[model samples]
Target: MSAGSRVELYAAIRRDARAGMSGRELQRRHGVGWRTVQAALASAWPAQRAPYPPRASKLDPFKPVIDQILVVDLDTPRKQRHTITRIFNRLCAEHGMTDVSYPVVRAYVAQRRPEIRTEHGRTESAAFVPQTHLPGREAEVDFGEISVRLRGELVTLHLFSLRMSYSGKAVHRVSATGGQEAFFEGHVHAFKVLGGVPAGRIRYDNLKAAVAQVIGFSRQRVETDRWVAFRSHFNVDAFYCQPGISGAHEKGGVEGDIGRFRRNHLVPVPEVDSLRELNEFIDDYDRADDDRRIGHRVHTVGEAFAAERQLLKPLPVEPFETGLWMTPRVDRFAQITVRSNRCSVPSRFIGRQVRVLLHASDLAVYDGRTPVASHERLLTKGACRLELDHYLEALIRKPGALPGATALEQARAAGAFTTVHDAWWAAACKAHGDADGTRALVEVLLLHRHTPHEHVIAGITAALRAGALTADAVALEARRAAEPIDSAVPEADGHTAILTPDAAVVASLTHRRLTHLPADTRPPPTVTAYDQLLRQTTS
Candidate 1:
């Protein structure tokens, strides 16, 4: 209604009241409700009306069901949790609640979902008390998943970041896993990088690597035994935040560092040859980040860290072993199983137990205290990392297996079995039958144990060209390839180099011999041995 009309209505009612007209009579004459009559009698202008009481919604009966579903959804994966339509359908089917419309359900769910989340402690409320941090007293640690291309393969690595609560200085490393070993190793890396352990407690979430169980919504935790040992060894005082909020509010420094570092430094998805390379990249960024000023601070991160370093506790003289120690028996195939992944050892180690030092990224097999083999740790279950050199003895005995061996396949993939090796093997197989040729190739492969790999390859190429398909001939050629020209000496046996050296190639050595003897003595170097190829060809 227009204000002028409302004013005229109120004026007529008030003028009647001033002339002693009854309230009921004014209401009847004005054709208005008693509330309007009272309002007009009370004032010449309209006053704001009192709000009406809320009427119950059709969804009221099913709200408890909605709350129960949302409460259960807290334990479910986010994507698999309930939706409004799903809730509405459940209410219709299970509770026989068809009176509630879809719009009503959606509206109630929209209003109640977050409230339910907060009530159940699945979400933190927006308001948080601001905290004052003292230097060297506290730190925060967490792991975040980061994807990078390692040697042209896209691999997801867990990045461990530890940020000083006061200084904003942090250290970051990428590991193959976020398991306990990596967790412990990450702490060691941070402590070493920062030069000491925090004098006060380090804040952490309920990481499975540390906390085996959160004690029912409280700050208490049943920590893993290994984590307890690690903490004691490092002289670390560990403080776990309340389980419900996931410790993010208490440890925002490391939480923010993980995201901020990933955005500013790890963007474009770093491509590196190894985890070592990726970590070096992270280290460079961390050093550069030290100069950054955090949130109106007078001192830069590095400057603050420099002051904080003096307050840190000195590290222990003895270091803790971060790798897991195990003794896995080598199987018949000369392979040992470490956490469901297979790695090969030398054939001699078969049926024997070898000590394994398994780190996050790799595992090393030791015969007693002497390290025998080490392979990069395999992430996928049942995966194998076979080294061909470990199987050479077996391959020499059963040459048939050499062609189809998994070790050979891995060697080929690793470039240890090159095209040159394949070419030489093919040539040998052509000269002899497949079995004998492969046997001879195996013998040639055995030369790699004593001879340089490049020299062995050269020997194979030379023997293939000369049609000397025997392994002995390849060995002779390999020795000749390894010999220096001036120091070349002929073996006084049936075996000799197929090709003789030219005089000009060793003229200095020949001149020295002639000068020591009479002029006619010490005849010049000859290619007469080389001419045996022509004679045999003609015959």
Candidate 2:
């Protein structure tokens, strides 16, 4: 019977006894035993049950062997340690204890293994202690691997998360790499997002980006020089936890935050065209998370953060340069190698050393402060990112190479080189042989630097319709495309001059008045009148 039912029965029996009823009569009325009636009458409650005597198990004889194995296993690697089956088999083979079942050994080992570990100081719970953080003083940083579909290509990206301990406010950024550049950039972004830096200390693991080497088993770590400089610049105080699994719990808040954010926002595997766009989405989600309450806290995350924001240390006035700097020699391919991936520069950079600033998602190449080229960071090793505009000079000279060039293929894939270009190229080739036609197209491609893309496309279309395959003709048409259709210039010399408003689009103004002038049909300005004068003179 349940405790409530027993208590109710006891109360009913007491009430009947209060009316002077006999114990046997109470038992018959309540449908309980005489002993229960007596006990209920004696104390008005159920008596505590008696304890049973200790009993022996079938595996009691092998208890010593199991203890010995477990004791030894405390020092052994986890994978190489003995299992319950191993213990049972060992007992049967060596101790000749046959009749013992696997369950008997399993129960004893399961109960005893943890006791052995605790006796040897191996349990993690023994070291766990609840911690309270001062507002805006403590934070945790962690990086997790997240997957996303970028432009229909599935890629794994590194997510850097910084979570405030007091308010549970977090700032997250996705990076193409988990390197130091990204590490520094994440810090910068997080600080700006939070509006300040932690005043006391931020907790972290022994990531290679920060910690160079952990000294012995203590908290002292030899930090990387760049990390040291970064800390100095931002006035940051870093507190590293113990190494390995033991250290994971030190920053457990951010660890849990990573999993939570990924599940709540990234579970469906977001598709994006670029990292910048993906980060913007992340920023929105992070702000939305502020409305959520953490655990049973009285205030929401945003409410708590409002109070903590004032306590945080002020940000530095000067921004730190987070991009990594490298000097790479441009190879024969007119590309420079960065972390095994290659990015193209202008062909003039070939055989020359160029300074490159490599960031988390892109890189900019410079020739002594003059920015030569820049590209989105390549994710795959040994993969090349090229721009067709970079090799225009060489490709024009060798038009045959254009068809097979990697740059052209990349341009077509990027939609920078369109079908109109192809159609125009085909017509140009048919009109003026293959070599000359490609050169004309190259000249048209060069016009992009001077004219807007829409104007250039208009020019190409107009040139094709007018059957003008030359680059000069395309330039003139492109300039015309940029002008207003309703606009007209002053009529001069029996010709209408349609001048381009933007003189830089072309060399000189073009005249269209001559075409609009009426043809002379009166006498064709014939010399018959002059012929009559000559006849009279001859007479």
Candidate 3:
């Protein structure tokens, strides 16, 4: 009923009429309605009976080419090549046809091509291979390679995906490096997405992510300990397809799914700026895909997953630790390099063995069973740094004897000691010419470990005021005090003064007399000679 079909019908009807064929015969030959043949005949020759309106042609431009290719290739052997692909290639290259897309070209070629004949010239059954699937019983897993632009560089990323066959629900996770970590991460994400694990089994190809070696038809040697732990944790059975033969009908669903997802979602090479942006876009895509119902099913993928939630086993009490474990030798500096980042342990641990846990973004240093320190993963290689503050007490005890003592220098540059304390030490070194001052100041800074900053500042002020400008002097005074106390007490005339009622009364009277007098006030309160003698005697 399309325009191209109508044109072809008109041409066929005119040719048949000139050949003395009836309208019925024309209709049968061209597979058109009788009215369509009549209308074409009437429009071409009008002397006879007029028929109804003509049907339109759907593929007008390529019909003649399709017919010619089919006629010429009929006598050729079927194993030589595909005539359809040849026709399309010729149309685009030699004929310069740009509008003929692959699907449209395929449809035209299929219409003209004769059905395959058996040895006896009889037809054979050509039915589609139906996919074997059960509700909540089957899942397909695969890894797809995709190009993503991250941090101004085009990176080829591997996306591991799992999809339930019946519900068409899917979960996918991406990683820059396709390894055991990415593989397990994908499974974890898929379990989260499906809401529950599938009732039947998980199907996979013999990817290195899942299998170490194929020993037999029913056995596979898996290399990663974490992978074994993962399957054990989830309590789900895993089934791997034959190695290198990824074409089983049961697994073909995920194959087609990869093409569909790549075309519909990852077109133009997915130019995302960051991993987070790519993840958000992927989440939106998953939501949209989950909401769409397959065929006429009443339940969507999301709804189906929700219904199947209770069937899944509970997640392990502790989440799978996605880290690479390795035994690293602690250098003389008591440091280990993980992913090129330097992390330090206690100085006593030098030349000792330790375990390092290297994650995607962090490195955890462990001495025996105890965690010594953790640091952010460094992106670049070379001498990465860890602060000595993390092991300052241990380092201080060893002092110059400690390896990688630059940590101490870094602490000094950050002003870990007071300037006055430093000055007192320098002056003491000049006066007494010894490290006793430095040691004394170090003790003073240590004393402030539990003391408030303000209190330390007041103590330093008191020590300086009390003529303890050198480290030795300050230490002497501090030892004499011993107990923690406020150092901001006011001094008067080389003696500690106390406020009393008689003194308050005298001060108030003096203030009143001074205010009542001129701007340039004179002393108004004079201790009488007798009172002065009594105060001096009391002092």
Candidate 4:
């Protein structure tokens, strides 16, 4: 028997023995093993005079007072309000109530806690029609919370997801914050992944990012200006579902997708050293999800998307820059602060109105229609100081004129210029003096304006090796090297010199040419005539 059962058995045995009842009777009464009854009888605390019923709660008498306190202090925070122990002490000291124990007070408080319900208001369930959404016609968007180990810190990351209702296509991204900036960035990335914008309306939860207030299931209070601007830029309509009504049936496709992704991919929590690395891994996972098959469709999500790609709206000529636009006063230093990072305008812009275009990746400064400067977006919020390197060229040319450079000095002091061209300046200064080297380095930097940095560096190195270390010389060489060469060689003529053969007849002749006789030459004819005449006379 368990200890409790043993205790009960012991009590039952004691009760039966005091009543002069047998062990059998005790077992029958208590429903315990005979061994338990015998063991209880062996030894232990002295038996009580009579069996006692469970005691009534000591705080039962103070129930009315506790309820009255809760009624008056309903608005107070639970921790700040009177706790069980506190109430017990108060009762003993002030009310002369001493019987109530901590347990009794705790039970009484637990019973009363549920009775104090504060109602904000009742929300009506939205009436929704089960529309048969066509393929490529509708997409559902939502945000989920994920814990990611970023740079060794456990951060709550917002994962924005877009799921096509038909093909079950999904796009997911991790953002540090779940504000409008993150919302727009998520859309931008989702569009790129889909390779085009969806043709149908998008469904979204009544989040502050997309909606300003809940008017009803069909209508919402005025949308935020940022969201309106986004809708205008993308030329798509946004729809909102009733608050607190998110479920699998309403957005079943994406709801399941979020769970699947969370369980299969997000579990174990990804530990990434950098945001870029985390984003890269997310891209890979997105591609894998797009390539997977859904339902009974023989085609993969990528294939289905290919068929639907043509139906999507064409992207605008200039893609939307994800940012929150704001107007802030230029400080005496000609700088405006956004999320604590300072950005500078020309000193001329000081006291004058200028526009700040903030983006997830960059910050653009504009005066009227013309853009004044652009810088990479600052990730953290705080006094983001501007860097002088951003406007040094403009400042130097308009020296002493202020050029209305508001944030230039702030930007300068922010160490922005420290690294902008530090390496190039260092190299140039090392090779030459400060003025000449900086000028040369500036020219080298200018090369990057036209060519890639790698090519510029290579050209600089080549120039230094060839003894053309001056900025002008290096720049000229770089220009010449960049020109295209005619790779084809020219054609040649066919003519060649030749020597004529000599005759052998000259070999037979002496140094001087002898006079040749006519056809019947001299000696043979005279000898024959003299011999014939002598023979005739002797006969």
Candidate 5:
């Protein structure tokens, strides 16, 4: 029985004994033995049970063997370490301990493994001190993995996140890779989005972008030179957590922020056409997150940020350039290789040196001081980015190359060579031969440099409807579509010298801009009498 149950029984027995009830009668009433009733009546508290003496078990004889095996396992790799099942089998096979059951051997090994680890100097469970953060004093930065649908394909992207220590306000952006360049770019974008850098230190784990190596158990670090320069440029100090698992608590806010955001915003796995579009969605999510409150806080995150923003260090005058610059020679194919991926530039720049600036998600090529081409940077190695416009001149020269060119295929994929353009090309091909038609299409594409795309498309549609297969007809229609509505007159009441009836109607329409003129108070001029006098003179 439990001590409480025994105590209650004893109290009841004492009460019944005081009332002159016999011991046999008390045992019958309480459903207890006569001896138990007598003992309960005599003692005030419940009787204590005696301790049992030690007894031998089937596992006792095999304990030493189990301990020895575990000791040997300490030196071996963890995967090859001794399991309870292995120990049981060894006891039955090698030691000839048939009487020892699996459960007995398994239970003993479970209790002894911790002792083995303790002897080998493994650390015990971890504990952390709680912290209080000052407003705008610090922030924690980390990168998390996320899956997004980019250009109709599912891709895993690295989400760079920063959380303020006090306000719980955060900013997140998606990067193509978690490389050093992306790390730097994430910071630059975060600082700009937050409006300033934290005056106090920012906490980080030993991410390779920042730390080159950790020095011993002291938690000191050897930071990368680029990281040092980046921090110095921003005039902010950094605090790195201990090298590994021990440092997780140091930046716990951002660690939790990443999870909270993923659960709330990224659960549906955002679908977007480009990385730019995905980042824009993230930007919107960050803005919407301002309405949320941190635990037990009186104000919303946005409210807290308003007060904390003033305490932050002012932003630098010029934005930090967040990309790598390289000089690459345009090859015979009019392409420059960046990170083993090919992106085309203008054919004019072929066989010439060009400056390439590779950013986190895009790249731009410059010829001397002029930008020659820009393309979304391809993260995949050996992938190519070709523009049809880049090869148009060459295609015009070698008309046979127009149909099967890589640039032509890319143009179709990018929607630059639209169905309307295709329809116009087919009609032209039927009117003129294939080579002449392709040359004509290339000529029309060159006009896109000077004319708006929608205007040209509209013109193409009009010419197609009119059965005009010539590029000149399409250009005329497109130019007409692009022309602005004539809302006002250019000349000041000086034109329109002839006052015919149609001219009078136009003059009436012009009255809106010519409101300063007096109303026509005099009688209308007699042009009919003048016409009759001219008729008599002619007769």
Candidate 6:
């Protein structure tokens, strides 16, 4: 019987005995064993049942043998050490210990193996130096790679992580590359997301974007010129950790944060249409993370951040422009290739050098003081980013080129060339010949330089309904559609110029009167005409 049951029985038996009831009656009432009843009647404290009797283990005789094997393994290479299975096999074959189960031998080895290793002095453990972080004083930065499906294709995205040591708050963003521009852009984005920059210092690994050279065995670094400029621009200082493997421990917080966030939130590969969409998901995940507490800290991360934010350096008046500037010559195709991806420029810029500012997500091509073109940076290799407008003039000369041109294809994909455009082009081709029709379509596309897209579409629809297949007619209707609804007068320059009464009066009043006849003209011929006028007045 259990101790509680025995105790109950004992109390009951004592109570019944005090009442002059016999032990037999007590046993009959409690339905307990006879021995239990006797014990209960004899003693106040109930005795616990004895544990199961000890039996000789099958592994006992082989204990010394297993110990000897483990001792020998200590000297051997770790890879050749004796596993439990090996020990069990040796016990059966060498020791001739038949009928010994593997589990029996395994259990003995497991309990005794650690002791043997300790005797041999092979066990070791790692120790970490405790760290203290002041609020908004220190942060760590790192980049990790994640796979995301963008536009139905799996793409490798570089994730930049910045973690505040005090609050355990972090900011994460995905970039197309780990290039210097992206590195700088990531910092700008992280600072904005955190609402300010760390007041004291930020630590980093020896990323090539930041560190140009590592001097000797020390952590002294020669930072890249652009990186130094960026640091100066932000008015923040940087501390580089020991280079390579040894440095991983210095930024352990961010290292751990990257792994934890990746596992908790991004384990199932994210599906998104663009880097922008993927970052929105990351932003939401970061906001949700503020509710979490770091380890056993009483305050949540957001609460801790609320305190730390006050200690941080106030944000600068303007964000630093995060990009790399280069002068690249436009190729014969009017395209400048960046990182093996082609981006189009104006045809007039071909064979001439232009300024290219390559940002993390986009790039701008400039001619001296004028911006020639801008495009979203292509992440994939050998991909081309072309704007059809850049090639419209050239395509007008080679009308046949518009149908199969790469620029046209890009335009169609970007929705700049819509189904309405296609319908108008086909209608034009039927009304005119193939070459002339393509030229007309190109001219209509050129209207986008001045007309809004919705206005152009409306014009196309209106012209199609009115059976006006001419590009000029289409452009006129598009401009009319774009006119303001509340204006009292229509635009003058768009339609042909006409002499309104106000314009006629202003032109007539502004004409200059001749004071004398020019030497080159017949002099005094005006006097004869005046004499005739006077003669008519006298009559």
For candidate 2, the TM-score is 0.80
| lDDT ranking from best candidate downward | 2, 1, 5, 6, 4, 3
Q: Largest lDDT belongs to which candidate?
A: 2
Cα lDDT tens digits, model 3, 152-258, are 67867777778888778877776655666667767777777666677788888777766777786654655456677777778777887766653354487777777
lDDT (10s digit) by residue, model 4, range 1-539: 35565566577688778889898888888877787677778864434346688687766677788887767667777568877777878778888897657776888788776665433222345576766767677899888878888767787777889988777788988776677888899998888878777788888777787777777655555688878888898887786665675533566667678788888787799999666677788888888887788777798988877777777787777877687677777776667877767766656677777778775445688887788777655545674645544444544344443323444344345533334345555666677766666556545554555675555555666676666666676665565457433343222354432323321122223322342434656556458788899999999
Candidate with best TM-score: 2
For all candidates in order, the CA lDDT equals: 0.87, 0.90, 0.67, 0.69, 0.86, 0.85
Off by over 4 Å in 5: 1-30, 33-126, 212-222, 295-300, 303-307, 483-539
For residues 1-539, could you state the per-residue lDDT of candidate 1 as single tens digits?
77788899999999999999998899899999998888887888786557899898877778898999988998999899998888888888899996667998898889988998888787754687889889999999999999898878888889999889988999998898888889988999999999999999999988999999877767788999999999898889999987655457788888888999989987898888878878888889999998899889899999999999999999888989999999999999999888888889999999999999988787888999999998887767899999988988787778888887988988888777989889888988998989889988888888998999999988988888898999999998898789756435344484544435554342356655675886567779999988998999999
Give every collision pair in model 5.
Answer: none
TM-score of each: 0.70, 0.80, 0.46, 0.48, 0.75, 0.68
Candidate 4, residue 245: Cα displacement in angstroms equals 9.8
Off by over 4 Å in 1: 1-126, 244-246, 450-455, 466-539
Q: Which lDDT tens digits does candidate 6 get at residues 1-539?
A: 57786677688888887899877787788787788777877898987667998799877788899899989988899799888888888788888999789888877888888998888787765578899999999999999988888877888878999999999999998888888888888889889988888999899999999999999988699999989888888877898998877779999999999999989999798888788888899999999999998889999999999999988887779667788888988999988988788888878778999998998778888888788898878778999888899988888898998889998887888788999999988988998988999999999988898888999999998898888988888887886678532322233365644444335222222222332335566555456788899999999
Q: Find the 10 residues in a row with the least total lDDT in model 5.
A: 498-507
Pairs with steric clashes in candidate 2: 495-513, 496-513
The reply for model 3, stretches above 4 Å from the true place, is 1-128, 145-158, 216-226, 245-250, 255-285, 293-299, 310-324, 333-349, 360-362, 368-372, 375-539
List, residue by residue over 396-511, the lDDT tens digit for candidate 2: 88999888899999999988899989989999999999999999999999998779988999999989988998899889889878965533544546676665655332222334
List CA RMSD, all candidates: 12.8, 9.9, 16.2, 21.1, 8.9, 10.4
lDDT of 5 by residue, 416-490 (tens): 889999999999898899999988888888889999999999999999999988889889788877964344444
